[model samples]
Target: MLAERPWTGYGFESFWGTPLLLNQDQPFDRAWDIRTIVHGHNGYLDIAVLMGIPALCVAVYTFLVAPLRDYMRIPLRKENIHLGDFFMMVVLFAALNAFFESFFFHRADPVWLFFVFGMFGLRQVSLRPMAVRGRS
Candidate 1:
């Protein structure tokens, strides 16, 4: 699917044509030029190189920075429940999963979004404090 859209072309010309300009007199043939840049062999290589570096950075941040920040802000030894902390954890995981899917997979699915919402609902239900206090 990603192969279909060249940044220079209008619709389908770049993917399935003679690679010629429809309008030679114009300042530029936008479609042919963009198609050349995006679908050409060297263009693909350039995109791969560009995308790979940032992807690696994000991976490191996810596995390293996130856990470290979580540990520093919240004491692991405490048994008391904090609603905000739980919510943050849920959001972090959901966001990370979404980011991975969008970056690596190149496809969007609603299942991850559903999972995020489900986690939020479950966290809210579980963290609700009991209204009655030791009267029974």
Candidate 2:
């Protein structure tokens, strides 16, 4: 629904309380922009956000970078990679984040969902297929 860079920030407040979305307000900057700020005051949601790190790692292997080729239950076929899948992945990650922020967090966040996802691609080890067990 909303579109903004991960680094620049993407929060509900930034969307509603800033000039970019709301009129008559100055453009947001890293500093002096109250709407872009977030705090971990929420209980379980705060913990859930922290839990995302490991979930994401598994998602990447499941959806994009299945390193253990043989053991991977249903690796996304390389030939089947599609632009839609990319967007879907981002949406899935964002939805997970939004659940925490909107439900238990009791606060909103401008989380960089795609940033860590992208980093997985950038920093991943070789994608060369490997068998977890010997060829019996």
Q: Which candidate number maximizes lDDT?
A: 1
> For every model shown, what is its TM-score relative to the native structure?
0.27, 0.20
Q: In candidate 2, what residue range of length 10 has the lowest lDDT sum?
A: 1-10
After superposing all C-alphas onto the true structure, candidate 1 shows an RMSD in angstroms of 12.1
Candidate 1 error regions (>4 Å): 1-50, 62-64, 75-81, 103-136
- Clashing residue pairs in candidate 1 are 8-34, 9-31
| Root-mean-square deviation of every model | 12.1, 13.9
Estimate the TM-score for candidate 2: 0.20
Tens digit of lDDT per residue, candidate 2, span 20-52? 434445566535654444434442233334334
lDDT of 1 at 124: 49
Cα misplacement distance, residue 96 of candidate 1 (Å): 5.7
Model 1 C-alpha lDDT per residue in residues 82-132, reported as the tens digit of each score: 543554565556545553333222235464454445444444434454243
